[model samples]
Target chain A: MFGTYLRRELLGRRRQTIIIAIGMALAIALVIIVNSVATGVRDAQAQVLRSVYGVGTDITITRPVTPPSGTDQGGQGARGPRFDFGAGAGDASGDGSRTVHSSRLTVGFGTQTMAATSLTTVQKVHGVEAASAVLSLTNTTFDGTLPSFGSRQQGGAGATPAPSGGSDAKGGSSFDVDSFTVMGMTPGGRAVGPLSATTLAKGRTLAASDEGKHVAVLDSSYAKSKSIGVGDTLSIGGTDFTVVGTVSPTGSDSATASNVYIPLDVAQKLSSQTGKVSTIYVQAESASAVDSLKASLQKALPKATVATQADLAANVSGSLGSAGQLVSNLGTWLSVIVLAAAFLIAILFTISGVTRRTREFGTLKAIGWSNRRVVGQVAGESVLQGLVGGIAGIAIGLIGVLVVNVVSPTLTGGLSSGRGVAGSMAEGARRTFGGGTGQTGRFGGAFGGASSGARSAAATQVDLSAPVTAWVIALAVALAVLGGLLAGAIGGWRASRLRPAEALRSVQ
Target chain B: MYRLKNVTKRYDAKGRTVTALNDVTLEIPDGQLVAIQGPTGGGKSTLLQMLGALDRPTSGTVELGDASLGTLADSRLTGIRGTEIGFVFQGFNLIPTLTALENVETALVPLGVSADERRDRAARALESVGLGDRGDHRPAELSGGQQQRVAIARALVKEPNVLLADEPTGNLDEDTRDEIMDLLEGLWRDRGLTLVIVTHDSAVARRAQRRLHIKAGKVKELA
Candidate 1:
């Protein structure tokens, strides 16, 4: 009977019902779109950090003591105030014997002040797989001529002397180029800090032999500006260096903006600072090993602050992420507005529905139908409207996301790139575990399977991908149901309060 | 069987104690067709509303069978209204959203009737109202008289012991009103329902087994 009543109400009030449905659909869609984008950003950042910079260590250690005062550190300051890295600090676990240390990136800036010796000791800690020392130099620009491939470039002034050479004599003016953050690393560090070799745009990465060779690998952005290809020599900070490789464009604001990599030894030599490194990158066997290892390292060297890969990523990307969150926050507020609009629309539709059917309700009450049943009939109609509207709104919202992505590619920062990763993980997990295949068989099949497997492998290659589509779908459905229930409650309450006798009376 | 003793209904509308019923005392025996006749605002509808348990009397006792109407909670009163009394209104108050048949089926929903049985019974009621072929029509599609008949059918579908109608033929023309009146009289006689109708039409009042005249919230027997 309820079903029959619901059907009749919907059929009888087509226009009003459709309007309510549309409102619900839009609200659900907004929620889905916002959630999807937020999830996308989080996944994308993790991927670029991991794939481009390998599964970084579970825990990292730096100087236990603050860099002695008066040390002039250059480049961007650590995100937070430099903590006192003094040794012998007590651990949070109240074990007075345990000490904590900072990561290399968190250590004081500048070539001379970074405590490389203190970081190297982490390698001696138990459960330590590998540790590589890194020096991050900021605000350093490469002043060189970029050779354009067009006729316009050919007609312009050719390659000129670099600005730091003290001769603007070549008509190539020093543009005060934007500085990219340069990180110095050794080839052995690549095992723990993996950079996919296939993504190298040009030349080769630094080899172990290239330690003091004054060789550097630049991101595609820097490489493009300097017009310096593999085997090309460029002067940086008064030191001549060979451009041995170029990293593929990751499109991350930080990665694309100013990143360059060079051998630690060579960078130290070029900067005239020997036996000194800026920060150290360490990796543990698993995430679980982090806290214990951090404790041991802190106990061993108390002046340093220890952080996990996720922690460092968050700190480095926090400002950027916060900015993104602001956008998402705005989106959230917009969604709230949409919800308010939905409520208003629901009210209007419901009021109109009630007013239009006043006599009908009166008639129902007159025919031995209780107020509860009459209310149910009215509310059932509202719920039907909400369901249809919610679903439709979600569909439109998804399309909107896609349209925005296409129209402004840079707006979303390649969220679409991560979709492949999500799909492949499911397939890979299914094929490996569901097919009764052992580790060896799974590995073998993954490498040797047919074209489909290759496709799967390609799909699975995302650095960090976790599927959140199910979450999005669930949230949408839940919103729809909630909206429907709310509408029903209000409509039912109004229906129940109608006075049958008054409703049947004719107006004067 | 029904009994009313000194039933009084007062409304405090905008701070005025308007009496819609005053010191009304009456007994309605079983299986009787009675009409409460009055002009506009003469308290006939108020009396019927009180009788149907739709409203509480300001003071007094109303007994339907052995149960007291004044003491029941709202929900309980609703249950009583659904089971024991069926009402037909002047507007033919058919749920516009429902078809002629489904409108009748709504009366059986609270009865916990099975879907098939509910449909069968609703169909039977619609057929009895001379709308068997129009079962699928919504109230909007039916004439005012036909709609009133649908309302009558819905009320009778529950086979209530008492059938109350307020201006059951108010919206219909004379010919249609006569036809509806004939149907109501036939149903009352055949089903032995304790029927009470509130109407301004003297012709309708004359057909009842007993007629009572009401004026200014008071009732008197029209010799």
Candidate 2:
């Protein structure tokens, strides 16, 4: 009997059911789209991490130094020597190092440089498949005489004065300018680090033969800024060095911020700090060896901070944790709020509908229909509406995700690791996905060299697209139906309270 | 079959209490046709409601058989109405969405009757009321008299022990009113069902076995 009544009532007044269903569907759809985007971001982060931090690479070691006083950590306007961002590093205090026996020389000032020769010791450790060293020269200027990179107004001035009195113990010299970094890479280091051959934009990687040569490979963005190309000459530290090639790193490739890459031997000779590297990246032979290797590296370089890929990811994500969490859970919280509104509207509409049909309910009551039966009839109608609404909501959510992917621009934002990590990560992604050299080509011609600001901004630009999944669809549909049923129950209870005599007697 | 003792029904209209029925005592035997004649708002409908268990008196007990209806639960009263009584109204209150046959079957809904049995009984009831051929038609498609007959079929399909009619012919012309009255008379005589009717016409009252008149919320026998 209730089923019969429910079918008849819905058929007779379809508009009301449709209106309520649509409201619920809208709420559910919003939830689905938000969750999908959140999931997509998380997945992209993992991919970029694997690319920048080599596959199977377990432990990264670096020193944390306090930024020079008066220098903006934001890195804007700081003419720093660009270092190829190595694996993300950690903090150390007070040159915490203890000498331990090793086959080759191992030196550490923990707060500054480690022995460039430490690579052999790290490689000698069990479970270590490979090891590489990096020497980053910060606050470097282009001899302060060549056209300033990215200025585009060639031969503008003689030399900009270097900042006074900040010393890097490893470089053993004061930087002339704080605009770019020069990263010194070991012969085969490019093959394993963030800015590897795979990520080179327009140049060949530095070779073992280039160790004594003053040839440098500029980062694509830095090359564009200086209007330097392959075979071009760049003056560094008062010596003319021929440009070998330009490289671009994307998606957490922190090293790509380096204005130029030169042989470790050349950098050591120029900086007057022979046989010293600032960071070391180590790869464990197997996944199972990663934990033990991290533990051993920490013990090996007690003063230097050692981190695994997971730890590095945690640090990067920690910087943006609040923002990511806000974005990820925004869907759930928004859905709850909208569902409340939808439920209220649905209930109000149902109550109003029941009120209009008071006489019909009264007639049923007078014909000996129990209040429970009346309630059942009302509830049955509502549940059916909920089911319809849930399905529609899932469809709407899927469509919304598709539309967003089609219409929205790539989203870009810097990580706390600053421009280096962002640039390298972006470059890595470009290479991994086989991105065209449209940007690189434009850098060579129309755009000439992207300004430092444009390049930094480009490094942070990441593609944003939602990846919908079965779980999101199922959850959204379930919520929509539940919301509808709850609204229906309220309406049914109100309808059941109507009295036969009074309802029939009412004028309207 | 029906008894009312000192029945008083009051309504709160805005602020004042309006006495719809005041201190009324009434009795009617089974298988008898009783006409209650009164002007509008003379408690005629209120008295009919009391006997049908559609309402409870504010002060007094309404008894159907030996049980005081005021002592029974609302659900029980609903059951009593389904199995023991039927009602016909002047408006011919047929559910507009349902066909004539469905409208008739609606009375059997609370009885837990099987669908086949309910349908068969409804069809027979429609036939008894001279609407067998009009079973599939909606109330809107039928004439006013035909609609009234559908309502009658609905009321009779339950096979109740008592039938209550409140202004059964109030909306009909003289010819249609006579036709309905004759049908009611036949049912009362042939089926031996207690019939209680509220009417405004003295001539309609003349056809009943007994007549009661009411004015200003009080009733008096017209013998």
Best by lDDT: 2
Clashes of each: 29, 34
Best by DockQ: 1
Q: Which stretches in model 1 have alpha-carbon errors above 4 Å?
A: A41-113, A118-131, A136-183, A191-263, A282-326, A355-359, A362-372, A405-408, A411-468, A499-508
Which fraction of the native contacts appears in each prediction?
0.51, 0.46
> On residues B1-223, what C-alpha lDDT tens digit does candidate 1 reach at each position?
8899999989889988899999999999999998999888889888888878777888999989898888887677778877999988776666777788888888888788899999999999989999999999988899998898888888999999999988888778999999999999999989999999988898888898899988889999876
Task: Enumerate the candidates' DockQ scores in order.
Answer: 0.46, 0.39
Q: Model 2, stretches more than 4 Å misplaced? A: A45-67, A70-79, A82-341, A405-409, A416-455, A460-463, A506-508
lDDT of 2 by residue, A1-508 (tens): 5566567667767898789889888887888877877776665555455544554456767644433457533122233223231222222223221111111011111124657767877878888878887665532221111111222233357764332211322211211222345667876565466454336677687888787888888778667765778989876665678888877765543335456678888877776668777667787888887988888887877766676766655433332334356665776688778888877878888788788777777778888989988887777777777777778888898898999778744543333343332222222222222222112211211221222211232223445567888898888767866776776788788878887774236232
lDDT of 1 by residue, A78-150 (tens): 2212224233342322211222322112211212234567666778888787777665443232222211212
Interface C-alpha RMSD after superposing true interface residues, each candidate, one decimal: 2.4, 2.1
